[model samples]
Target: MRISALLIDDDPILRSGMKGLLSMVAPEVEIVAEAEDVQSGIAAIEKWKPQLIFLDIQLNDGTGFDVLEHFTQSTTRLESQVVFITAHEQYAVKAFRFSALDYLLKPVDPDDLRSVIEKVKKSQDDATGISHVELLLENIKRQTNSFKRIALTNSDGIHLFEIADIIRCESEDNYTTFYIRNNKPVLVSRTLKEFEELLRDHGFVRIHQSHLINLTFLKSYVKKNGGYVIMADQTHLPISQRNKERLQELITKTL
Candidate 1:
């Protein structure tokens, strides 16, 4: 399916470059509208109702957060998949990852942009984009503390879950299985490391290479034979020696 996308950035030169790159690498994504500031971006989104957006974190009048917040607070749901473009370093990129949002660095790498486009296409849950964006906006506003929702995508589709409901994640080679409350576990086509990167700061700990546990569901710590943890689900997972100290630290601070 051809994707109608909006470009929102303050720098005309960067926008021009990105447009050229998109035409070259992601021809399936057509630029439907362009805006240089928060107000114009919001207006473009309202008017065009594009399926995708290339948003700059910084704009002339206000930050991209302002634009997202406007859509989030609006009565009508915002129907768009956002891919943030920014020059900010580690912290901001971490923010996007934690929210499970796609983002590209400035001077937008062609391969990276292509990968992101492919991911968006594979998602196939366009109807839930608005809720995903809203969750992302909420996560950004609260940072690591308010990780209320998480998006998991697989062959079935994108599934959103309350952070508190997730018990733990078990690795299946390239895939990760998310164990949740009152629901069967979900197997997503992503690495345990990817989930670790996204969830580590949000009340999750990688106690072992194959396991990422939500501290909220931690039931007990077993201190025998390299140590292990008992989750609220009653499953026991080993704690790698490398991660043992850190896990203990987090456990002490958390509980």
Candidate 2:
């Protein structure tokens, strides 16, 4: 299947290199237009209405974020899938992860690019909801440490949840089940390890190999028989010895 695409970047060399790489790896992705800045990028998008966009985070006139904002705030809906190409911007990267948006780090790797292309193909069949993009924009507007929303994608669809609403997470192999307040549990395909990294700073602790709990939802830590924690929903989850001390330290800090 041929995918119409636009490349928006300030560096002509990088744009040329990406075009070359795409020709070799993703021959189906046809580059319809290229732009060097926010205005031209927006103009190209309006003209081509490409199926995919490879956007640079930093442009000559304005950032790629400016381009997205221009469309997101307008009456027109951006139906195209965006892949942000960026250097090491830690805060922006975290926001993208929280929003469940796709991004590529510079300089791009062939394997990673191929993986992204595969994801794009899969997304075509099961398109992600526009809520993901809205959540991404919301996250970008907040202080990194104060990001309040997260997007979780499963077979059913993408779910937007307030970070504080999550009670705990349970792992079964590569999947994680999120227990939320006043909502049904959400099963996500992503690994517990991935969530552990993403949510650790937001008052979440991996108490065991199979259990991650939100500190705000922790009811009590029971020491009878074996150590375990009681959650807001009264579900008991075992605590592993390896993480016991860390949990205790965090609990003390919270108190």
Candidate 3:
């Protein structure tokens, strides 16, 4: 399927570069229009109704977030898959990951751009994209360092879960199974190490190589033969010898 795309960036050179990259990597994507600022970007979006949007997070007049918020707060639903473009802002990158949104770092890499296009082609669900944007907007609106919700994509579909509701994550090779409160386990294709890094500051700790647990749902720690943690769901997960002291310190601080 041919994809119509709108490019919104303040920098002409970067826009030209993106156009060139898209042409070379994904000939199927056509640049319908281009805008250099928030208002112009919003106007182009309203006029063209493109299938995909390459949105720069920072613009002269306002940010790309302003453009998305305008449409989100209006009666029209944003149906295009949005790929956020930005310089390396650590917090912004984290927000995108938490919301399961696609992003490209500035001085965009061809491989990353191609990956985004491939994902857009595979999942053309407009609702999924809009929901991710909404989650992203909500996360940003909270004005907190910690993310309240996380979007997890499985073979079934993308599922949004409250971060606090996740009891634990069990890893099996490259797959991680999320055990949530009042929800069935969600099997995700990402490795445990990735999640550990993303969730470490949000009260999730890696007690073992295969286990990441939410401190909020931790019931107690038992130190019989070896250290183990009891989750609110009543699951017993072992704590590695190396992580036992760290877990104890965290538990002590929490108390």
Candidate 4:
């Protein structure tokens, strides 16, 4: 396929190197345009309408997330395959993996870049690929320590859930079953710790290694059976001895 691409990054050296690498590795992909900042990136995206975008996370003018927010909110609604290129090594990367979004770490390895290009091509052809982008955009819009939605992948496809609607999560081996409001419980192929890291700041507590509960849905703590939490749905979940004191503190604060 003749893939048209836009490179949006603050570092001229990195962009130039990437251009050369892309030319060598994926000659079919044509560099349509390049931008050094979020504003120009948005302008280029609107004007060029490229098939792929190599987006940098940080820019002098604004973060790459700013550019994505613009496109997401725009009425015209342009969808392009995005491969985030960043130096940031943190929670954002975990979110990317959870959402099935593609990202390249800096300093970019030629082999990894080539692999990402191939993945982008494959993702471009998949019907569900764009949904991952939408999920990532939703996550990017959230403030630190606060999130409104979570995207989970099931056999059918990606499922989006409002954080407020989720009551609790239970671990079963590698899978975590999310108990949600007005919907059947959805099982996702991920560990509980992964979710704990993403949701800890957003009022989710790990009452036990196998469970994570949203504080909003917590009704009361029962002293019986060691210690247990009563969710809004009246389901009883055990609280770990190690986490008991911490959960109590949170419940007190919530009350």
The C-alpha stretches of model 2 lying farther than 4 A from their native spots are 125-130
- lDDT for 35 (candidate 4): 98
Best by TM-score: 2
What lDDT score is found at residue 202 in candidate 3?
A: 86
Q: What would the TM-score be for candidate 4 when compared with the true structure?
A: 0.69
Candidate 1: pairs in clash: none
Stronger candidate by lDDT (3 vs 4): 3
Decoy 2 TM-score against native: 0.95
Candidate 1 error regions (>4 Å):
124-128, 145-148, 155-158, 223-227, 244-255
- Lowest-scoring 10 consecutive residues by lDDT in candidate 2? 124-133
Q: Which lDDT values do the candidates have, in the order given?
A: 0.84, 0.90, 0.90, 0.82
Pairs that collide, model 4 = none
Tens-digit per-residue lDDT, 1-255, candidate 1: 899999999999998999899899989889988999999999999999888888999899989989988866788687778889999667677667656678999889999999999988976455436566666676677645556778786677668898788899999789999999999999988899988877776789999889999999998999997799999989989999999899889879975
Model 3 weakest lDDT span, ten residues long: 124-133
Q: In terms of TM-score, which candidate is stronger, 3 or 4?
A: 3
Clashes of each: 0, 0, 0, 0
TM-score of each: 0.83, 0.95, 0.91, 0.69
Native-to-model Cα distance after best TM-score fit, residue 227 in candidate 4, in Å = 3.5
TM-score-wise, the better of 1 and 3 is 3
lDDT of 2 at 254: 91
TM-score of 3: 0.91
